[model samples]
Target: MRGGEKCLEVFCEIFPEADLFTLLHVPGSVSPVIEGRRVVTSFLQRFPGVERRYRHLLPLMPAAVRLLGLGGYDFILSSSHCVAKAARGGPGAYHLCYCYTPMRYAWSAYEAYFGGDRLRGAARWVVPPVMKALRRWDAGTSAGVGEFIAISHTVAGRIRSCYGREAEVIYPPVDTDLYHPAGEPGDYYLLVSAFAPYKRVDLAAEAFTRLGRPLKVAGTGQDFERVRALGGPNVEFLGWQDDAALARLYAGCRAFVFPGEEDFGITPLEAQACGRPVIAYGAGGALETVVGLNPEEVTFPAGFQPPAGEEPTGLFFTRPDAEGLAQAVLRFEAEEAKFRPEAARRQALRFGRERFKEQARRRFVEGFERHQEKTAARRTGDR
Candidate 1:
């Protein structure tokens, strides 16, 4: 499961009977924890080839969400980075959103997703106005959410900026049991992410090309061809990997390469859980999760030491481009021996799946009970 699905899994365990509402639901596409639920899909699920063309159906998502039936439920919990936040609850119904971020498409990710070579022809011109309307709709609908929980401070900031709303930070979970350290790491560095524009997979391809080092990128999405075009023979793209294969990839990688500034990434922690250190861009959620050691020669002064006092789980490059990442990789190679597999695994343990489930259950229960009290008072006053 990806970050969102991982979070959803915790909720499924918390509330087994909660109806899953979405614009689309491909059977068996997600974990059994979710698939076993009473899943309700919107009108878009009926549209021909909608599953493949769903990202293109952005303009229709608001309407699609509106058609979703949640009449009987007084508490609607949304795991959203996009349209789910717009799912309106029935009168006095409490909508609790575990936000990944304000919708990236409707926020500052325009240049990455719609600009440059990512978007072309008439559609490039067409999508901006749609995004603008979505931004308004996104902000307008924030009123429905009784509370917002962000996966990280980075995402919490975006929620405030986008919707003029506040959010409590609740870091997501990683399945430490499933991702524990296994065999020895291999020669290649691993970069696992969907080829979304903001992910900067193209930069990873370019960085490995410059270093002439082995780097394998797992997962594919809208920017696949563009990223593949930037790579040399040194870089290999593995389309999509299952959980078992992915665990092996993480446990066997020399180090995980994370080039994106995420809301709060799960992959790096997953890699750490598998006893792999990460080489990442020093921003966003990476700062929170990674115990990043900066290079003495480059990042610090002649005598200056970068200190975590215990152990460093990863290395961070202040620069976000290919050259920055390539240099960080070199620094990582130089300081590689200092990083231990078990140490990294210990760091990953702090964000274990069970811990997140506990936190989620507590928050959801508290919010649901508080909402019930408020609803009772309102009904009593009406009488």
Candidate 2:
């Protein structure tokens, strides 16, 4: 399961009685915990093989979301990156949205998703207007939600910018129980990521190629062939990995390399959970997660960069390029001994699975009660 599904698993444990809603759900494709729930898929689920071809059906998502039978539901919690937050609930329902991002394709990732100048035929013409409309609708739907919980402060900023709403940051959890420190660390640096355009796996491939250092990449996607082409003999692709295989890779690697500016990077935390250090681009979620080694080299916030005595858990590259990454790797190598594995383990523990469950449940219960109070007060005034 990906980070989103992993989060959903926690929700399933939290509210076992609540019905699951989604645009599509391929049975047995997710965790057993999620599968056991009473899943209510949208109209898109009626079409065969929609799971594989869902991204191609983005134009239909808004319509599909609206058609979902959300009536009579008193509490709705939408785990949303896209159209799920727009789910209109029954009257007096309190909807809390755990937003991963404010629709990246319509905003920050438009260029990456659309791939300007690479488009051909009708898609070149048809896709643009649909995204424009999506942006308007995406922003408009924020009013329906009673509260917003961001996966990271980085995402909280995006929520403020896109939806003009403030959000409380609740960082996503890492399964530290499954990913613990074990065995001797290996010589090669590691990266376990989807080979997508935004992931910038090519940047890692190119950096390792320049440094003539070993790098192991895991996972595959639409941009796999393109990223693979950029990698030299020094870089190796391990393809998709199961949980056991990924935990092994995390524990064994010298360091995990994160090339992209993610909204909230869960994989880096997973690496840290395994008592492994990370080398990441010094932006977005990395800023919040990584306790940087070379504070002067990277622009950290008021605390991390200034506090010279803190045991650094990772290194950060200011420039988002091959050369910058190569240099960060070199810096990590020079002072790698100073970074204690235990410190990384402790840092990862701060965002453990149980912590997330506690916070989410508390927020939902408290907010639901307040919403009921306001609803009752309004009805009294109406009378």
Candidate 3:
């Protein structure tokens, strides 16, 4: 499951009877914990082939999400990467949002999502103005949220920058119990992520191609064809695998490659939980999760070395491109023995599912109490 869905799973467990509101709903797309709930979809769900072509409706999403009309709910807990945070609550209702990021496509990831070659013809001319409007709408909707719980410090910073609001950071969970060390690692490297443009799967494929090392990618998305075309003989595509299959791949890979800069990447932690090291780009949540040699730490002439008693679980490439990643793979090969499986697994435990649940519960209680206090004060003033 994706990071947002994983968080939603916990929310569903905590509030089993709560109704789920969204812009669209594709049955069987998410876990039973979520799908089993009374999911209320907006007008966007009525659009023809909305499940597959939702990205084409990005410009209309703000209106569609706002149209969800969540005013009657006593408490609304929105798990938002995009417009879900914009859901309107009743005057007395508390809207607490667990924000993944401040709409990446509308903010920092604009080029990655709608850059040259991706957009075409009339669409290219239309998207810029639409994105500008989306950004304004995104910022405007932040006022409706009573409190914001960010998925990571990286995202908290973005929330502050984008919406002028502070948020508490709670790193997303990884199923360490399920993804624990199992079989011996295979010779190949693994990259498990959607083939989205921002995910930079193409960078990983090109890096492995240059290294002549086997790189197995698991998952598919909008950029699947583009990424698949870029892969050389050494790169293998294993489109969307089941949990068992994913766990097997995680346990068997020599090291996991995370080329993208995520708000908070759960996959890297999942790989670490499986006792496999990671080779990631030195940016975003990877900076916090991956305890390894960074580019800045790599001094010329003498090069970099881990201090005594220090245990690294992965390595980071300074650049987020093919050549940079290829160099990192070579570096990992050199000091591969230093990255102990036990150490990697230990690091993974720090962000366990139990930890997330506990933190989220505490935050929710605090937010609810604050909302109650505000409502009481307002009632007293009116009298």
TM-score of every candidate: 0.93, 0.96, 0.95
Clashing pairs in 3: 186-252
Better of 1 and 3 by lDDT: 3
Shift in Å, residue 316, candidate 2: 0.8
Between prediction 1 and prediction 3, the one with superior TM-score is: 3
Cα lDDT listed for each candidate: 0.86, 0.88, 0.87
- Number of the top candidate by TM-score? 2
Candidate 3 has an lDDT of 0.87
The 10 consecutive residues of candidate 2 with the worst lDDT sum are 299-308
TM-score head-to-head 1 vs 2, winner: 2
Relative to the true structure, candidate 3 reaches a TM of 0.95
Candidate 3 vs. truth: CA RMSD?
A: 3.7
The deviation in Å at residue 196 for candidate 3 is: 0.7
Compute the lDDT for candidate 1: 0.86
Best by lDDT: 2
Per-residue C-alpha lDDT of model 3 across residues 1-383, encoded as one tens digit per residue = 68789889998887778888888888998998888899889888889998899988888888888788777877989899998898877878898999999998999799999887888899888989989988998999998888999887778888989999989878889999789999789999999999888899999988888889999999999889989998999899999998889999999999999999888799999999999999988777776777875546532211112243547899988777899999989999998988999999998998999999999998898889988998999899999
Candidate 3: worst-modelled 10 consecutive residues by lDDT: 298-307
Superposed model 1: Cα runs more than 4 Å off: 295-308, 378-383
